[model samples]
Target: MEAFVSTEDEPDEVVDAELVPGDSHLPVIRHQTPLVPDADPDAWLPPEAAQDVADGIAQATRDAYELHFTQFAKWCAMEGRRHLPAAGDSVTAYVSHLTRTPREKTGKPYSPSTLDSVIAAIRTVHRDRKLPVPETKGARQVVTGYRERLALAKDAASRPNKASPAKRDVLRRAVRTLDRTTLAGRRDAALMLLGHACATRGGELVHLDIESLTPDDEGRGFTARLYRRKLKKWQDVGVFYDEDEELCPVRATYDLIDALELEGHTTGPLFLRMDRWGYLAPPMQREGKTIGDPTGRMTAEAASDIVERAMARAGQPGRWRSHSLRRGFVNSAREAGVDIVDIGRHGGWADGSKALIGYIEEADAFSDSNPLAQINEAERRKRGAHDQH
Candidate 1:
């Protein structure tokens, strides 16, 4: 198998390789070689086949894999151990190191999910290189042990970091605070309402275009055609007219459309970036021609920030994130007596999804079926009977 090579002049000695914010001194490793060296170039994959192989995974996943693999390589270089075709013991030791090490900025060790991703990244790189993936049973056991430790800790950081739901009340308050006349306000209003109505993820919200929306025959709502990445298909979600015009998703959509149409943008991205001065950023271009591009659309991070800012403005405290809309929809629907399966379908959750089931369980925690609720009701009835006697 090919050995990892550093880009630095001295191969034996590791250079500045700290992974810190604003630190550009991390060592780069040249890792493009095949896992097993071949004397004949014909042993390598054809260019087209290699391209297809590369395209198998999503770009975001590929980016993450590259980052995690690079970090692992740096650690190996620092420890004078082989990274590519790594030994099982080395993999276990690395997991332990990550579990114990805390980030300089956050002063917190990597979460279980992050540690899992690191192992996945290592496996992916090996698989991509046509190498046998290193044994991960020990590495997985280490992660499981860490998870058990966190569960025992029972602290805020140990608990799952769930996003606060933007329930109907919270959404209403947040939308009412927005200035409807301003471009940013109108965009945000539409973004939030439509996002909630469709139970959209941040990426889905930003990827929507004008062409994706179609009004219903009764003019009572709009059907948004969204491509579900997880399901790998297009699904239509209904955004109905609300009784309260102030919080109506349909009204918000039209208002934003009218505003954008007035600005000579009747197509392309449904949500766009706006400068502080209230000017919409123009569509991105390539070779003097406008193209459908991410640069012209709102980013997932920006969408989350907007939700966080809206919640702050409404004085609703808690950790609100982009996922709040989807979660809020599920919880609110469950409270309104909507069937669990229907809620899952509307929110694009696969049938019998454990995640959707978990949300339902949380929403039902204090409902009529709970023992505590039944006990409280019985106590109230007993007191009322005594008072009557």
Candidate 2:
């Protein structure tokens, strides 16, 4: 279960004894004990160490950590480096690989910040294990900065990648044109509202259900109470207009509910999907993922897949993802001159959502995706060409 290295002092005979049974940190565990090193991720964590991690994190957090760990393990296997779980070097190399290598499909390299996340994932595991580790970029500011600089340099080497405004326009155009008459349109509209409403994370939108949503029966409008996954708590954001006007968060969704012959408490699902023929029967829920009934439920993963499928149905590009809706919402709101603070509150953002501030940052702020600014530079090139001629 262990792969070991020999030190010069050990004369090339040091066995991977400590790593075997993966309780490498265990203090002389007996062979009689039912030890399973394979079950333990990294074997670096003694049972005590894992117990400490268990104490430090919630069950869900631990589950997430394990999930990420599993993914990192799989990525390592794909790269023919399954020995990584056994050594810190493997972890570091894997982090470096994520930063240095480009994805095969997109051929796009990870951003500096994205690469930092990869490093963070590895360091988290080591920290949980209480293992001795080198001062790496993820955990240390200096190392992180260095890694970011390296990542940026690689990006430069690749080319100054210019994101085309045409890409954004194409998606927006499609969303604007989706059918609004059928039940499908209402569902799409509801999806659009969330995506464009706050540029909501796809995961947040999908997991949103009946119990959490509140609608005013007076037909004035409704309110949605979202259990925000990223923030680890619930935050309420209401979108409803007066008796005369129509400005509700899920107004389109409400219309869909009526069109589909659905009714319930404010606690019922806001959006229950119908079959291809527009059947209104609820789908079975994945148990424990939610409460009581297990039908007509939606999931973030499923939401994303649904969005993609819907986009394809709408004749939009495949790359028009759920996130495109969120970004579109943010972009459209900003363009309409809606203040950032107001935008944040509507989007269910917590106070000091500095991490999500980039959504409000104008394209000209970075000029990274501002084609208009980039286009002006071409005039200088043309002038230079004329002068030389």
Q: What TM-score fits each model?
A: 0.83, 0.58
What are the per-residue Cα lDDT tens digits for candidate 1 across 1-389?
11223344755654567765765686776677686566565658877887777776666677777777888888987897888678777788899999899865699877888888889988877776656789999999999999889878864555677898888889999988899998789999999988888888888888899889999999879899987766667899988999888888888988999999998899999899876788887565689987655447888878999999999989999998888988888878888889998898898889999988988889888787678999999999999999999
lDDT of 2 by residue, 1-389 (tens): 01112122633323334543555676884566554333556556666765774665544445655654666777665665642333655666666666566766678665555545555655676554444444464334533654557666664523323221112344445445656777666676676565455456766776666555566778555666676666667777665552311223366666666665543424445555566776644554465464423556555555566567656665764455566666566565666567778877777677668644765664225443467667778888899999999
Best by TM-score: 1
Q: For model 1, state the Cα shift of residue 133 in Å.
A: 0.6
**Model 1 TM-score relative to the real fold:** 0.83
lDDT of each: 0.83, 0.56
Which pairs of residues collide in candidate 2?
137-143, 195-325, 196-329, 199-326, 210-267, 210-268, 210-269, 283-295, 283-296, 285-294
Kindly report the root-mean-square deviation of model 2 from the true structure over all alpha carbons: 10.8
